[model samples]
Target: DVKVTQSSRYLVKRTGEKVFLECVQDMDHENMFWYRQDPGLGLRLIYFSYDVKMKEKGDIPEGYSVSREKKERFSLILESASTNQTSMYLCASSFGGRPGYTFGSGTRLTVV
Candidate 1:
């Protein structure tokens, strides 16, 4: 079975502190993505990497960035965590051009 793992299940951050959320997948999938899920807002992509050392900004990449140095790991970094950044962050992985995506449980981040 494919599994995506997030570093945190819950997080609380100060208004302007930097934050990092890590995700690792054991499936050796070629595509890894980061998304933020919010109530009524649906899932919005933050970043995605299709290959090692390559990254692309997703729909909502303003305050966040991602790293993918290896095929099995992806990291999401918040330049400066803010109240507006508080949301459930999810990591997902999929095989090349596959229709369905498998997601991690999610990290509920609260920036106060």
Candidate 2:
């Protein structure tokens, strides 16, 4: 099994609905992040947490929120799903300020 796991591999949501993407890490990493990938836009950071209950906004945090109530769990919340938000979401974790991240198999979300 992968060290980092995302709750869903694929999801479909209606516009204006709330959506939650869950990710869990088994390695006890100190940093966890959420990113969205598009056809040519590449990976854009949406949110991140360095420790439990601590979160920071990343490059594309607008329309997205995050929760890190526990060390092993990090959740990304889309308050209102939109077609513009449809993309592949990635969850990653790292420890000791390492440059590399262990990523979960991405979640493909489609908003209609």
Candidate 3:
């Protein structure tokens, strides 16, 4: 079974700090994604990579960026964290065209 691991479960940061959220998958999935869960907006995709060294921006990619240097690792970067960016961040991995995905236990971030 595929297991997605997130580096941190909770995070607190100041208004202008740069935050790095890491996700790793045990299965060599071809697709990896980063999404933020907000109350009203639901789960909005921030970034995704289909293969190593390749990425495509999702609906809400303005305040974020992603790196997929290795097949099992994907990293999400917040250039400068802000209060509005505070939310539950989820990482997921799946085989392309597969029916289901494996997700990490999310990282809840708060910016003061």
- TM-score versus the correct structure, for each prediction: 0.96, 0.97, 0.96
Over 1-112, each residue of candidate 3 has an lDDT whose tens digit, in order, gives: 6589999999999988999999999998999999999998899989999999999999999989898999999999999999999999999999998857789999999999
- Cα deviation at 31, candidate 2, in Å, is 0.4
Position 49, candidate 3: lDDT: 91
Q: By lDDT, rank the candidates, best first.
A: 2, 3, 1
Residue pairs with backbone atoms closer than 3 Å in model 2 (clashes): none
Whichever of 1 and 3 has more TM-score, that candidate is 1
Give one digit per residue, the lDDT tens place, for model 1 in 1-112.
7689998899999988989999999998999999999999999999999999999999989999888888999999999998999999999999998968989999999999
lDDT of 2 by residue, 1-112 (tens): 5499999999999999999999999998999999999998999999999999999999999999999999999999999999999999999999957889999999999999
Task: Kindly provide the TM-score of model 1 when superposed on the true structure, using C-alpha atoms.
Answer: 0.96
Give the 10-residue window scoring lowest on summed lDDT in candidate 2. Answer: 93-102
Model 3 bad stretches (over 4 Å): none
Query: What TM-score does candidate 3 reach?
Result: 0.96
